[model samples]
Target: MGNAIGMVEFTSIARGIETSDYMIKAANVELLKSSTVCPGKYIVLIGGTTGDVKVSMSVGEKYGGEYLVDTLMIPNIHSQLIPAICLTNQVENPGAVGVLEFYSIASAITAGDVAAKAANITLIEIKIGYSIGGKGVVVLTGDVGAVLTAVEAAKKQCELLLQTTVIPKPSPKLYETLL
Candidate 1:
C-alpha cells in the first residue's frame, strides 16, 4: 500500500488521548501530533502505509465515539503535507505566497495536499487551529503564477473554506512572520 496520513479531532481531550493511544498500538504507524488545540479541542495525527493508517484510523474513530469532531485520511499524500502540518517546512526567498483558510483542520490539510500536487509550490505551514479560534490555515509559496494556480486548485477541493488569497510579491517580513 502507498503511504498515508490520518487525523482525528475530538471535542474532549480525554477521549482524544485515549484514541491516540489505541491508534498507535493498533498499527505500526508513527504518531505525528497528539495535543489540544484552540477552543479546547484535541487532535491526533498519524502516518504510515495506507493499510496501516486505515486500520489505526478505525481504532481512533471507534474509541473517539461521541467526542469525535472531525477525521481525515489521505492515501499517497503529498510529501510536503506532513512537514507543513508539523510546522517544519523551510521555504526561503519565496517569490509569492498563497493562503487558504478553513473552518476545520481536516479541510486545510486536504487542501494543502491538493495545492502541493497541483503546482510547483512549497507548503509553508498548516496551522491546526492553534490560537486561531479552531480554524485551520494553510500557507504555500512559489512563483506568482504557480501560487495562483495552486491556491485555485486547493480552494476547489476545500470544504468549509473561510477565505483564500495569493500574494504575488509578498514583503520579506510577511514570510518571517508566518513561522
Candidate 2:
C-alpha cells in the first residue's frame, strides 16, 4: 500500500503540542489565529504530503455568504491528523505534517466526504464551518500520484463555489519561484 494525503483547515491553530514542540506549534498557532480572527476575511488553506506540509490563508470572501465561522477548524485538524494517527496506530507517533492553503473547509469536507465514499477512503471526522476564507490544510501520503489527484479533485470541486485564486502546493517545479 502507498501513502495517503489528507486535507484539513482550522480557524486557529490552537492544537498545542508539548512544550518542546512549542516553537513550530507557536508559529502555526500565531499564523492561524492572525488569519482567522480577522472578523471577516478570506479563509486559510493547508495541504500536506506524507513527509511534507503546506500552509496558507485566503484573501477574503469569494465563496458564499459574507462572513463565515470557524466551525470546521477543530474537526479539520482532527480529520487531517487522524490518518497519520491510524497509520501509525498511535495517537501521535510521527505526528501529522501537513500544508494549509486558502480553501473552503465546507467545500473540502463536502468533496472529501464524496471522495471518501466513492474511493472507499475512511473519513477521520467532520466539523461545522466557520471563519470563511480563513485557514485550510492538506495532508498527503502514500503514492504521490494519488495524493496529487486527490488535491486536484478537492480543489476542482471547491472552485464551483469558491471564486478566489488558489495557490497550489509548491512542488519542486515551483520551489524556485516560491523561494
Candidate 3:
C-alpha cells in the first residue's frame, strides 16, 4: 500500500484489461485490484508513489480511449481506505456513522479516499459494483463532527451523489445488520 492510489474504470472489459496492462508496464506502480464490476464494467486499482501513480493513470487513460468511464488519482489517500475497500478489517460498534452513495464504483472509491483523508474517521466498508447494480456506497464512522466533515469532503469529490446520510446514533439492530 502507498499514499497514492490510481484507478480507472472502463465500459468495456477488454479495453480495461488492455489499459491496465499498459499502465503497469509504463510505471513502477503496483496493481492492487483489477476485476470486473457490476453491469459488465471493469476497474483497475493501482498504488505507488504519487508520481508513479500519476504516470500509470496517464497511460491508462490513453489506452482506455472511448471505453473509459471514470478515472482517479489520489496523491494522499487515507491509510484506512484500501483495507476497508478490500474488506479485510473490521471495526466493532462504530459511532455516528455516515454513508455516501454514488452512481459508479470509481466515483465512490475516489470520494471515499477524500472523505477518509479529510477527517479522523474509520472507514467501515466500501461496497461497490457486483450485487449493487453498478452503484457504489461508502460507510464510515466517527464522532458526529468527524462524520459530517468526511461526508462533506466526499460530496465535493463525487459528481453523481445518489444519496448521503449521517446517523448520529443508530439502533443496536441496525448496527448488527449493517456492520
Cα-based lDDT for every prediction: 0.91, 0.32, 0.87
Alpha-carbon TM-score of each model against the true structure: 0.96, 0.30, 0.90
- Which 10 residues in a row give candidate 1 its minimum summed lDDT? 170-179
Question: Candidate 3: which stretches are off by over 4 Å?
Answer: none
| Per-residue C-alpha lDDT of model 1 across residues 41-105, encoded as one tens digit per residue | 99999999999999999999899999999999999898899999888888865779899999999
Tens-digit lDDT track of model 2 for 1-179: 11222223233233211111332232232222222323243334233332322211121112222333332322223243334323322222111122224445545444443334333223322222344333333333223344445445655655333332223343545433222
* Top candidate by TM-score: 1
User: In candidate 3, how many clashes are counted?
Assistant: 0
Worst 10 residues of 3 by lDDT: 84-93
For 1-179, candidate 3 gives per-residue lDDT tens digits of: 45899889899999898888999999899998888988999999999999989999999988899999888777888788888788764786489989999997878888888888899888988987878988989999889999999999889867889999999998878778777
Residue 27 lDDT in candidate 1: 96
Q: Give the TM-score of candidate 1.
A: 0.96
- The lDDT of model 3 is 0.87
